[model samples]
Target: MDLVFVFPVNLQKTKVLLSELSFFVNDEPAVIGLSENSDKLVWTGRLSPQKVLIFKIEYKGRGLDQFVYHLDPSLPVKNLRFISNIRGGSNYDYAPGVIPATAIEPHDQNNVSLTWDYKSLEAGVPVGLILPSEKSFSMLIATMTGRGWACYILFFISIVILTIHGGKKLKFYENYLISACFGFFFILLAYLAAFMNFYLAYGLSLLAVSALLYFYIRHLLASATAGYVVLILIVLFLTIPTLAVILQGYTGLIYTLEILVLLGMLLKLSTQRFFQNVMEELFGIL
Candidate 1:
């Protein structure tokens, strides 16, 4: 194989998977190519953005082995060890705009359509693993600022609510608060780990935070039930996917509104039971 591309990225930051792998062999590529199944990944914008990494392997195999990983920024060195592996297949689905029924109407549609459908919610990152062979690789690296003020702000609000809500169950909510904060620290972890990506770190944090919320809520409520499971699932469903998108670099209040809308829906639906019991459990309304 003359040209080969190996992908070692955190699946959570999946949107940029192809961009990353493509960069491995292609140092500076003129055109950005995406998987036909792009509608299935976490890609944020158009295939080719202006700022992309470009790399080209020398015809000589001198740099092929070195291409196993990126080394231009620094020399390889032994470290205080921390590495992560990405798991989970592409779970791309209808854009939130699609009706739930119509969205779920089809199956076996994981691959990106060769024909572009801009109206669809397929505006996501494209990832592809290229093999080393006689072919040349044009890698493009995208430098997107994955910053979302709404995520950050809701995070702040979540913290306040947890702190206030943790009356007698301070420990429980404190841990939940920790999970919320853990999401923030994940960014730093992404910055540190080479194979790790921001999406991976952020997505994993949801599971961590979810586990914490489950146990903490159980602790706060002193038991578990159908209701508690729903709460846990609610957090899991909302947080992980939301985290994935937010990590993509949309820093607008719309995200906050999205969260608010979800929370409102949750409140509208779950509040009757939540308020009836929450005040009693947290503030001892009884």
Candidate 2:
């Protein structure tokens, strides 16, 4: 029988240390010649029928993104049981074609065990684990930048609706300035986040933008109008988009719900007297 164990020594960022390697047959320590080449340990030995064999190896490694137990593609496996005790991250998944764990039990804070038991498995499908990758601040900023149009469109639409509903007129240049301010939110956040914590930078950017919008809208229209605009800015620009970033997996769901909620709000507001007057003004009939 030939056996091989592959370690993450060469692939990982940190050094991997192998402390113990042993093989036994028939409850006695058998001296087996083990060959080491790069990250793989290989051994070939003869086995008699009904003779039990056991091999154990221990290693310590760090910063490895994945762990996979490779099985010989030409052979069938029977009665295989694998368990992995994980620390730190909780989110994990299997590689393509790898069978998922049969049980996952949480022992304590930051400790969990994954178990897979199979009576038989065909060749080519191995046990694999995928660790969660940490999100980079730069990546977050990039996502925010790419999705910045959502924030601007929602804010712009709210401004248009509120101004029209309140019977206020906004000059072309005034609309341009408001759009610029909304765009500046992303630019300001990208720069600030590079110097400080992301959350702190985000809060500062939000406050600065909100304050600017509040004063500018109040100057152009009224305090009540400005208040409403500021509230809309917070919800659309800061709250919804940031939440979508934090919950990256559920971004589509969050945005879908946001669109539905906004649609409901617009339908309800359209029935009001002020909005009807604006419709009449624009089309000369309502």
Q: lDDT per residue, candidate 1, 1-286, as tens digits?
A: 1222323323343323332332222344333344465432122222344443323322222112111222122333321111111122123333322222222212233322111122333223232222223211111011111333444554444433443444433455565564464454444334433344444654565555556656755665455652265354445334543544444455355456665776886678555765446545545522
Question: Where does the lowest 10-residue lDDT sum fall in candidate 1?
Answer: 135-144
Backbone clash pairs for candidate 2 read none
Q: Which stretches of model 1 miss by more than 4 angstroms?
A: 1-193, 225-260, 263-286
Clashing residue pair totals per candidate (backbone < 3 A): 30, 0
Q: By TM-score, how accurate is candidate 1?
A: 0.32
Relative to the true structure, how large is the alpha-carbon lDDT of every model?
0.38, 0.70
- For each candidate in turn, the TM-score is 0.32, 0.50
